[model samples]
Target: MKIIFNRLYADYLMPSRLGEYEAILRQARDLGYAQLAVRDFYRSRDRSPPGRVLVHRHDIDSDLRTARKLFALESRHGVRATYYFRLCTLDIGFMREIEAAGSEASYHYEEVATFAKQWRIRTPDTLRARFPEIRQQFARNFDSIAERLGCPLATVASHGDFANRKLNVINHELLNDTALRQQCGIECEAYDDALLRHIDIYISDRKHPVYYRPASPFDALGRDRAILFLTHPVQWETNWIDNTRCNARRIIEELAWRTSASC
Candidate 1:
């Protein structure tokens, strides 16, 4: 089977990093990654994806000015991407611009219960006791966001919810939940694919490359088709300098050791 590389991405851009992001996008385009998946960028509202981490805030602003700048850059490239909107932080003018520029948009939601837990506002045990109700509320909130976006959303990805978690968080459940899938009209299933192993793919923790995960987006009934990639836009702006150096060192050390053993 020929392995095809695809990138599904999201980015939470901090206000200060707009210029850096421009450079990163330029590099991706030069390297042939013309398209990307995104959650929130420069939208500094709370519950938004934190810089270099999955943490959320109660009052982060949605850096709209910066977002507009990036949007303009994408326009010049003649490339389109999926931008998941946090319904609670929806800015009508911004949403209109996204549509005007021909970019695909969707919803970005965090299960309220999960958000509380992630922030240590509630313990996991407490969340488990109330998961059913929590999931319903979460889905409903997402539905509301979709309504404002106007079209039956084309695709969806989590805001601060990472797909690689071990538990049935909202994003994880949405990967295969028929009900949620039908509600959101999300075509691509979001799961922890093997290629996500390069830790450098994340901005917050560039000292390590992503370790591979075994789950496939498709069920056991596998097919040969295009593999979808998801990456964070703000995460891409972070550097992976240490990880790259470590990898190079390991490679050279392994080669030398192998030669010595042979002699």
Candidate 2:
């Protein structure tokens, strides 16, 4: 019953979210908020002038086409945002286009958590036992992706893989070790402590009706606030039919996760 309701909500109620996404971006621009990507915001967190700032980030979990559209829209509105791509969405051409738009393209990492799921490291002690191997893969993949992008990624956002819930581990947990961060050339994680400390408000479009759960971005405009926004391109739809298909896929994936995790 809940699954059916969720599918209806995603496929029907949220089809106009893409427009809402643009509306907020445009509103911020008009209100004199300086929009910056994740990398730039983090690098200059201390020296930011006293004003309204919006730090926008997009995680491309699926639907590269939608992500590209979102990128172009942001570029049109003179908004710079960081785009984090999973392994499937990392296209050199699109990433270069994003760079051309003056936005940051980085990695959305899930390798370590996947390793845990594959090895069935269901407990903290077992996960720690295989930490070496898992960490090695994380670094290797990060390096490999950086080499492919032809530049160092300033921040990597950990992916919340369904496998993570079954394994009792988070992908970014490995970033706790400062040494690992240095070895991988990661300047910061998406949820860095410093970022959380500095930002006055954090908003994410990962959930339903994101603009209003706590409050709307419009309400925060004109105030001196540091706002961090995380959006998944797949969640907002340009086509109703396509969005229905996407929602169906997610529903299937959710059911599969629930079933597999139970075993």
After superposition, the stretches of candidate 1 with alpha carbons farther than 4 Å from their true spots are 1-17, 31-33, 36-61, 114-121, 161-171, 174-176, 189-263
Output the TM-score of candidate 2. 0.86
Best by TM-score: 2
For each candidate in the order shown, give its overall lDDT on alpha carbons: 0.42, 0.77
lDDT of 1 by residue, 37-81 (tens): 332221222333322322111111133344455567667766555
**TM-score, one value per model:** 0.51, 0.86
Question: Candidate 2 lDDT, tens digit per residue, 80-129?
Answer: 99999988678978887787778899989887666655654446667767
Off by over 4 Å in 2: 11-13, 209-212, 238-263
Query: Which pairs of residues collide in candidate 2?
Result: none
Alpha-carbon shift of residue 17 in model 1 (angstroms) = 4.5
Clashes of 1: 33
